[model samples]
Target: MDIDTESTATSLDENTENFCDNPTRDTIAEGLMGLIKPTVDQLDERVRATRLSQVELRQCIEGLSEELKRISEDQKHSIDLEVYLKKLINAKQRVTVLSNILQSAQERLNRVHMSIDKETVKRKVLLNNTIEDPHSVVLSKNIGSSMSLQTPLYNLNDFPDVYEPSEDTHLFIDALEKDMKYIINSKPTLACEIGCGSGVLIAALAKILKSTCCYFCTDINPKACIATTRTAKMNKVPLECTRMDLTTNLKCKFDIVLFNPPYVLTEELEIFGCGLNRAFAGGLRGRSVTDRLLNNLNDILSDNGVCYLLLLKENNIGEIGEKMGEKGFKIKLVIQRKIPGEHLFVYKFSKA
Candidate 1:
């Protein structure tokens, strides 16, 4: 506290004359300052501690705010993950459903295609009946030929395991028709056919010589054997069938042999494989099955047995003739036909 000049003068006058000689005003002021100094220092220390505590509290508040923000972000991220998983599940289910629907649609389309094919065939048959003789059929011709080799959809539906007669089969029948007179002249007692699909070949022979000859056929497929028997019954011909691989187990000496082999080029493994492949899967150069038969032709034939077989252009006819010539057999091409995607020939083999 600052003292007024008048107050200091009065105080100095009231003090002892000896104190006045020592500057009493200055001494009192110094004493008062000394008494208040410790309290001032204590107040200063308290202020500093309060500021430090405030700073620490502010820092702690800031850390808590940061922690709350992190928790909020984590919550948001967890929600996002849950939504993503849900979307993935939904998409997967949709894709699976679509796949099943597409598969069903494809199956329906195939059925529609089959129905259309059958309808078309039926219409054609009706049209043919109107134009030609009503007694004649779409699958057969009786214009002086020994057999009608035309095929319709019935063969496929009736016998799925059996080969459906096509161009090769027709060509084979035409070849036999051309050589029918020669076959009759020979007057064979026993006739056998190898791999007689649909039994058309043997049935044709049986019809012409039913009384004089015994007709027999061998087929790798039981369905073909059944087809042969059925064909014989239809044409009023007597025929017997045995399930054998290219005359492998025949006990009779056949005077006439007919073969319409699988002549399409394919893998060797498919030569004897299951299904329709056995009908048309000719191995390398389309000669595996044909060659095997040719190798044993000498033993398979009788003294005057004549064998007729169908061959493809890929089967190397020159090599076949040379090989047959070596085995004392004469090979003559009876009939040839070019149809669609194939060039085919029916050859006659006779002992020289």
Candidate 2:
């Protein structure tokens, strides 16, 4: 019985020791797992939330990228529009310049056409007339009358640079014709024409007088000098033409002085140059060139000299007459005619 009781005690002791050791280890491991498992689950939840936030952030970035791309395209379109607008403006300027150029070309062409028409008319007149002499022709105011006046020989083509004879020229000739008897009675020794364009007036005077009286002409244009010589030779008249500014440096006084000055109002810049501008461009009320001649008239004229000046109404004829009166001169309106928009007049001035 004693041995049996001892064996039972030993076995019970071994069983208790094994049970305590194994069960304690298992309880400790289970407790550690329970605490760790909850912590790991919390960490896993936080990680999932972080991943969701990352996905939302990535979506937001993609949306912003789309917005930026749209903005970039819009900016690019605006730039293109600006470029097109600038090009359009440039094109408009170019078109304006071309238009002005075309207008100027048209004006020049019209002038050329008018010149050609004038030449044609002159040729037709010459052909129609039965001229006794090719160099000259007797012009009769009364048809079928033996009493006739001779005209200076002139070809329009010979004086291209000279101002063509217009109504003013004819009007001046008519005035001279009306006073031809008086002029012949005066028996002038010297006669001069200022701004003699075609030498028609002086040559006509020489023809009518048929005298050995000296004829002098002065012109600003050098071409006019050549034209005057040609006209005088063609008409068998003696004439001395000098390229000068209205009798500058001429020491002789004249009994008869004629001037057909530029009577068209124009810019000051257009006055006092070569070409047709010098013929027609009278600065400021068409008095620039005329005033200079008037200022020096008394010095250039003889005591009994007569000055026949052609003037437009725009030349302030009243003012010119008043100024001439102050200079001990009398003004007489020899002839006046109105044609188109202008009224032209020839005034004879003599010492009072």
Candidate 3:
């Protein structure tokens, strides 16, 4: 009975060894592969578009095909221990072969990735240029057309008594050119420049619009009117010269109005005083003449009117804006520039 029990125990041990060997190993290997496949498949997809040279990629694909063929052949002949042993050997070889191919694939994929990165940057630059073309083209064309107005020729003799093209005058014109787009959109019909000395300001605008609109000027001095008319004729712009004191006589509603007023602070007696003094005399902070027109400006301007007024820093622009605001007008502080003695500002006013 002892001998029989020993033999039975040996048989159980052999069966247990058989149960835990190759078949169990294959099951565990398949289970591990099942767990890793999703992540590996994802990585494969990410690199597939730019991995390996065409020739090398094809070779790798063929290698994988051969490996599948070899496995298929081994499965077909798996009717004996020799076949199973060969499959085990082949499986080890497959691991080594796949590892080598995958390493080669990684090296090639890195090179391809670098090339793609370079190409992508170049493509992005091209894309940006193409995108900007549509939006910028119209604006650039408009700017090109607007900027075509060169500085009009000024004869010192024609405007001898009137103020010459001084720094303030040049700055006023520059600011006008800067806001040309807004002025063009406003499309003023009856535009007037009060205190239009030598007609330089009106002529400049007339030339820009090619005399498509009627432009007029007002001055208290008859000699100024003569000088302005002569200056306008020289520039070949049709400008109506009116001898008046700050739009006091005329009740015409103007769409666009410009004034480079007498902004020098002086005593009350010097307000519109003698020869050149009349040109630039402002009593007590240069507000005398400017305030007079501004008080009744709403009636002078049309519904879609815009006024451009030049002032010095001492003129208390904030207070002026507040006063204008109370009279149903809003002010835009357009441009300010400082030179030798004075800080000049150009203010634009429109109905609120």
Candidate 4:
């Protein structure tokens, strides 16, 4: 009885080992079956017509065949193992044929892609060839040319509706709103936005302060002014839009004045070409408008009023603070937000 029990346990262990060692034929067959559909699809589509190299596909098949053949012949195993080995050899051959088909399809696709890329490059070269450098702008002077616009100075193409608010703008607006609340709590009468575009900034101020104070939106570009006015009306905010070229057209002063000037530096003039639109062109060194505005900042800025000016890092508008000191006005940045890739300077100034 003891001998019989020991033999039974040994036999059970061998069976368990065989069961674990055996490969599942169904799993291998399923994997091979998955390749068949994709290969057949490629063949039916005549993907080889596009200049695919059949040589590469042949190489893949040869590799799989070599691997499968070695595994089948070199390994002397049980009948179950031998049967599945034969199936693997067949699947490997099928993979080789599929590789050839896929290679041909890719070669054709490659040719088509090359042709499209070449055409695109040609068109870009032609367009760039026609584009004149900024230095040549002085030579192409015509009185009524597109460059001759006065008040609506910026070309419509200069500013694009990005549809997304930039991180810098978000931070700047938040800071501005906070400062706006401080001012409104103290002297909330009339608020004016200079160089307002799309009405986003002013609309935010309106919503935050929630005051019936008259809001004035002004932009040098007629299109910007009109768009901002429409946005204000849509949002049910009582605001007035006027085409005021900050250099000339603006006449009145307000209790609170907001200026977000186009302060992109000279080094980045590639963005703004010869079209000196009121929205973006900052003159030869990118400080022309900023310099003029700072000089006359006291005019539009009320006697005992607050002014919030958003300036670029390049524009040394901090010099304005020194000038304000001479006029007995106290000016501070109040709230500042440094955006990655660019710097925005916001100052809150009041008469001393």
Question: What lDDT score belongs to each candidate, Candidate 1 first?
Answer: 0.77, 0.80, 0.77, 0.62
Ranking by lDDT: 2, 3, 1, 4
Q: What is the C-alpha RMSD of each candidate to the true structure, in Å?
A: 19.0, 16.2, 34.3, 31.4
Once model 1 is optimally superposed onto the true structure by TM-score, how far is the C-alpha of residue 287 displaced, in angstroms?
Answer: 1.0
Predicted candidate 1 versus true structure: per-residue lDDT over 189-218, tens digit per residue: 998989887776777666556689988888
Q: Lowest summed lDDT over 10 consecutive residues: which window, candidate 4?
A: 147-156
Per-residue lDDT tens digits of candidate 3, residues 1-352?
9999999999999988887776878899999999999999998986775565666989999999999999999889756676567455434433433444345346545857986998698677767877988455322334336475555655555444566555567678887888888888778888899988767888878765665688889998777888888888888888788898989888799998989987766655766533455666676667899998898889889999989999988789889988889888989988888765568899999999
Going through the candidates in the order shown, the clash numbers are 0, 0, 0, 6
Instruction: Show the lowest summed lDDT stretch of 10 residues, model 3.
Output: 135-144
Q: Any runs in candidate 4 off by more than 4 Å, and if so which?
A: 1-165, 267-278
Clashing pairs in 1: none
- Pitting candidate 3 against candidate 4, the one with the higher TM-score is 3
What's model 4's overall lDDT?
0.62
**Which of the predicted structures, 2 or 3, would earn the higher lDDT when compared with the native?**
2
Backbone clashes in model 2, listed as residue pairs: none
- Candidate 4 local lDDT, 1-352, one digit each (tens): 9999999999999998887776786577778989898988888677665335576777889999999998898676645775567455434433433444355346545857987898688667656656745334233244236421111111223235311123334555756655754766766567888777667667777765556577887766666776676667766677888876663665667777777665554323333422223344344345666666667777877787787776665566666667778977788876675543455677787877
